[model samples]
Target: MEIKNEYLRDLYRRVEKRDPNEPEFLQAVGEVLQSLAPVADRRPDLIDWGVFERIVEPERMITFRVSWVDDQGKVQVNRGYRVQYNSAIGPYKGGLRLHPSVNASIIKFLGFEQTFKNSLTGLPMGGAKGGSDFDPKGKSDMEIMRFCQSFMTELYRHIGEDTDVPAGDIGVGAREIGYLFGQYKRIRNTFTGVLTGKGLTYGGSLARTEATGYGLLYFLREMLQKMKHEPVAGKTAVISGSGNVAIYACEKSQQLGMKVVAMSDSAGYVYDEKGIDLAVVKQIKEVERGRIKAYAERVPGAVYTEGCKGIWTIPCDVALPCATQNELDLAGAEALVAHGVMAVCEGANMPTTPDAAEFFQKNGVLFAPGKASNAGGVSVSGLEMSQNSMRYSWTFEEVDRKLEEIMKGIFHAAYTAAEEYGCSGDLIAGANIAGFLKVAESMKAQGIAY
Candidate 1:
């Protein structure tokens, strides 16, 4: 997309020049900048204040080394990163991803998107993201613990309940969060809600586990009703990924009267002509810690493919890419469109490539971006933050109700913003503009020091 506004164009140019090698971060920035031309035209004073320039730059970038001993008693070293992208709204809040693919570019991209995502939630949380290049696969429990301890040794100094509260993402799950929190407590000698996604015995919120998946459907429901004048009932859906997000998303889709026919993991995908059996999926993924291909073996008449991306070829009314970034490319979008997909709501961060998302919107498919739809997980994280501060937790029903309301509010906010800015029904533009306005205005109000 071309930046029609010269000021926004120059800002993007500077970002490109400074981070020439950071494609992911540059793509994120460019997407937001492409949507802000209307805002730039309306608010010339923001341009004068250099808000766009400052927003593109991180407030702080911390990198450290993590050393731990493996089961063989040999030492291993990995690089860790935390990019505190923005704190204009409130404290830095995002997840700590642990994957072999982790790097400065991925962290920065996630953090930049987090800033807007947090804003869309209408929470006081700002944006930040951190993670390590350490791959937790094939490691023993004790080895994972040692790695977590060493990672926190350096990270404990930079994070707190009010400073930055890190949650779980990707490879960082309940087990990882438990390990990370334990190390933080041992090092600090004090227990606080410095981290979300803790175990239920601790301060973790009741509905936090199901928040993202449920929230995606909540947002999708609103988008369908408001844009297409249709309900989610009777819609056949295909969701990519069989992890936490995908599993819960499948559960929620079933609850809402939709048939989720297919799900995938890194190795391959499983397709069931009938609605997916959630119990079997949970057992295979959560309990067994096995590949998705196992799903086909356990469930009779189901077929398993050997490639993850092939999952997109299935026909469905709704498509939720709950996997990783860029998992759904232009080809996937074309396949979905050809199959007459009505909506594409992201369950993972930037799961749909820009071209794929563009194709969806251009084809009159109702597309909800991850920042708005996937805000559910973080919405519950924000709720968990509140519960931690008060030393109180809400019931499962209460938390679920709150999450539904927040998702609905996010949809309307983006919808209204798009209509108000003359890009009616363009949720991509609406979400970017709405989220950017809040943070941009907050930055302008606080001056350039932030």
Candidate 2:
């Protein structure tokens, strides 16, 4: 793994030395750095200004303690963090994941990725990510509310509508967002649109829940049509994760005349050769708040498997990893390629390992990275910000249409950028180059600042 640019290599070495134990952060920085060779060759002024060095470091990193009482009348403590990674383009924008895996490295990686993801939307947004090591599962509503309040009590000081806006992620959904927003309002005494995933009655945008999944399919469809001279119709798709992204991706796939054969959760994956029943899955995972095992038990033709990773082995024409970071490794990519997968699109941030992504590319799989493919969530979040600012809402069709257009724009921008850089079909480099150039230019215009 040798870097081509001497200055870029030096910057990366500094990052590695400064955060040796932060593998997630290192991996993210390494990937972005690897793609900057084209930019470095074209923009030597950026190198002279040390843009790479400054971009790798966050504008601010805030960490605080969150202490709440559970239903058992015991005081529980958790750590919370928010990494305001970069704000060259606009205010910091990203999600907050309230999982036990929340850490500095993970938050930094997500924020670093968000910087580009937000830029790709062509919207005025920077990058930031925050979360606590708090697990909302098995907690009562009141318990969750108390925890959200505690988390927001310290977080409110660091965020605002025009400053840094945080939205929902893994464990942070509508329920948590409502709680956090209420707490922020209570503390700040302001009803500004500080959060995007609010209930529709309170300024949330429509089609947000389905944005990431639907957006993923839109981007994938365009890629398939351009590269393979076909649409998703009649393709058997294997998707990981049964959450909002996967469910909506499945819905969009079915609507596009494609059949989704598999979807998974943390416990395991379910495979149905006749295409997944999105209705049954929604009822189980959303309404019933149950694991995917219930889906297998209730669905007529679905088979349940034991582990999440094995979902990749299910034969399909397309594969969507919407589960979590690094969920799909070389083995999973190899399995999909071996099964003749035509395309691999990421619905989760950094879901596919670098090697896996390269493997898919080398094998002629039309691979779309999460930043470009699964950007619908934040793209709609940006729209939600607009609706909130205008104090108006758009119809579902309106927002969905706008989302489709944005995804298409993102694809062409990345596709063309890759082709321009003489790496046609290499969306990994294309997306990185496209997004990096946008933020880099913005940073340059703003002048160098510590």
For candidate 2, lDDT tens digit of each residue in 1-450?
Answer: 557888788889999999999999999999988888878888899988778888899999999999999998999999999999999999999999999888999999999999999999999999999999999989999999999999999999999988999999999989999999999999988889999899998889999999999999999999999888986888999999998899999999999999998999999999888878899999998998889988789888889998898999989999999989999999999999999999999999999999999899888899999999999999999999999999899999999999999999999989999999878989989999999889988888889744
Output the number of the lDDT-best candidate.
Answer: 1
Model 1 agreement with the true structure over 1-450: per-residue lDDT tens digits = 788889899889999999999999999999999998999999999989988888899999999999999999999999999999999999999999999999999999999999999999999999999999999988889999999999999999999999999999999999999999999999999989999999999899998999999999999999999999999999999999999999999999999999999999998899999889999999998998989888899999999999987788899999999999999999999999999999999999999999999999899999999999999999999999999999998999999999999999999999999999989999989999999999999998987653
Error of 1 at 130 (Å): 0.6
**TM-score for each candidate, following the candidate numbering:** 0.99, 0.99
Superposed model 1: Cα runs more than 4 Å off: none
TM-score, predicted candidate 2 vs. hidden true structure = 0.99
Error of 1 at 178 (Å): 0.7
lDDT of each: 0.94, 0.93
